[model samples]
Target: MANLDAPATAIIGCGNINRGDDGAGPAVIARLAAEDLPSDVELLDAGTDGMAVMYRARGAQQLIVIDAREPEGKPGAIYEVPGDVLAAEPVHGVGLHAFRWDNALFVGRKIFGDDFPSDVQVYLIEAQTLDYATELSGPVVAAVEKVAAKIAARLVIAPEA
Candidate 1:
């Protein structure tokens, strides 16, 4: 259970490291984990688990999600999307593996209500490939550093009431 009285920011990364660029999210989380972030911020490497994303985000004052987007002509392009714009209701009957962070966003709001953070930001990195591999493409590696630095900078800012 989350402590409703404690105000915190949740940063969740979702992805499959086994798939080439799909590992961007976890990569970012790994980088942030080594940095000195604010005490009020909680970082999670959800690793393709939407349920974990929702549970981890509970009671957070803000939520930031990082993931890789499917290839669409460009590689390593970063898109900062508002959560509401990407949030989708979970489809009934789908297995847990099919559930995604976007679905978690909708379900979390419905389940947690005011306990869930309304300030949600999603950063998507366009992938060059989703093939079975351990190394990230050159462009993705650069983008990961940029995204990690950007998130770290954002965490330093004081939260608004």
Candidate 2:
């Protein structure tokens, strides 16, 4: 559990809800919202809004982002990656909007200077489908629940660094 005085661990779920499996991020947000997490752990459903994601996460010391991307393996596969990898890996073309996470980094750095979270983590889910729909695909929903449960459990036991 996090200390009451410690900076928060912010989790931003980024995705388009109308687009089938693209709703993965918000799905995780919904799952995590139902969890009993530390007071310092703040969750946000930053659906397709990179600016809101960055602005909402400004003061957090440790940030975790959940998002959906193209399939790299199985449909429901999940990958945990360091946030700094965004710079090395080009992800500008992954979404229907402008570069989300990557540009948020640039914007945060440019605007906030040094107060932005440095300990950033990203959870990527392999999306099976991304067509127009209100609900997530079955595989994506399973992935969201799995990742959300894992994150909630991890946060409950994880000591704030």
Candidate 3:
């Protein structure tokens, strides 16, 4: 079991819910809200608002961000990568959005100072399509559930309350 009193872990799910597979992150976040999670974990639905996510994630001991990525892998494939990788591997928004995780690094570092925790992890799920639709396809839904559970398992604490 995870310790309940650990420092907060910020889970920022970034995506546009109006899009199909691109909405996977926010979809997983919605599902996470329904589940019982550790009290120290703060969940945010960024919805392509990247700068707000950076501030929301500030001061977290561990930050776990989830987003959709077309990594050219199998659909529904998941990746758990360290945060520093964001600086090296920048991402582009799927459609008309201009915000991406790479920009969040600059904002985070500017707000949190240079030597933040090196343990931040980002989980990117492979997206099949990112159409501007309000609903997610069946496969995307399954992927969101799978990714959310995987992220929850990585949580370090139970309810702090």
Candidate 4:
């Protein structure tokens, strides 16, 4: 049970629906829309607006962002990382978007100040394909559901007395 009334918790999912697995982020976010969340949480469908995601995260006590990442792991694999860890991790090569998650963290710092919220977290799901004009493949659709559950679990809040 986490505090849900401190600030808005934003879940930003980015991707191109026309593309293949690149749409994983957006797909997960879409699934979340069907659920009933605490009034303190906000879910945004920020397609490719990695930087803009930070704007929505300002003043949040806990911010959980969900995106698709290509890590050295199995496809559909999900990674849950603290926002600080994602921010501190160095960039070794080109990322999905020019900014990517690193940029999002940086923007978060700039917008909310250096020690930006302590509860920020990222939920990254491994992506299989990034085709520009294809719909999400079969595996990704299933993966989105799993990721959605993970996101919900993370956002869960206990009732206040």
Q: In terms of lDDT, which candidate is strongest?
A: 1
Top of the candidates by TM-score: 1
Task: Provide the RMSD of all predictions against the true structure, rounded to 1 decimal.
Answer: 2.7, 4.8, 5.8, 4.7
**Alpha-carbon lDDT, every model:** 0.90, 0.80, 0.73, 0.72
Q: Please list the residue runs of candidate 3 whose C-alpha ends up more than 4 Å from where it truly belongs after superposition.
A: 1-7, 71-73, 89-97, 114-117, 156-161
- Over 39-62, each residue of candidate 4 has an lDDT whose tens digit, in order, gives 777788888776666666666666
> How far out, in Å, is residue 153 in model 3?
1.5
Candidate 3 residue pairs in backbone clash: 39-159
- Give the per-residue lDDT digits (tens) of candidate 1, residues 48-159: 8999888888899999999999999899999999999988765574467787889889988988898888999999999999999998999999999999999999888676
TM-score for each predicted model, relative to the true structure: 0.91, 0.84, 0.80, 0.80
Candidate 1 clash pair list: none
Question: Worst 10-residue stretch by lDDT in candidate 2?
Answer: 87-96
Model 1 whole-model lDDT (C-alpha atoms): 0.90
**Would you give me the overall lDDT of model 3?**
0.73
State how far residue 140 of model 2 sits from its true place (Å). 1.2
User: What order do candidates take by TM-score, descending?
Assistant: 1, 2, 3, 4
Q: On residues 1-161, what C-alpha lDDT tens digit does candidate 2 reach at each position?
A: 22344347888899888988888999999999988888888888988888776776687788889989886657879999887777343344344366576678656656676677788888999998888889887888888989998898778765569
Order the candidates by lDDT, highest first.
1, 2, 3, 4
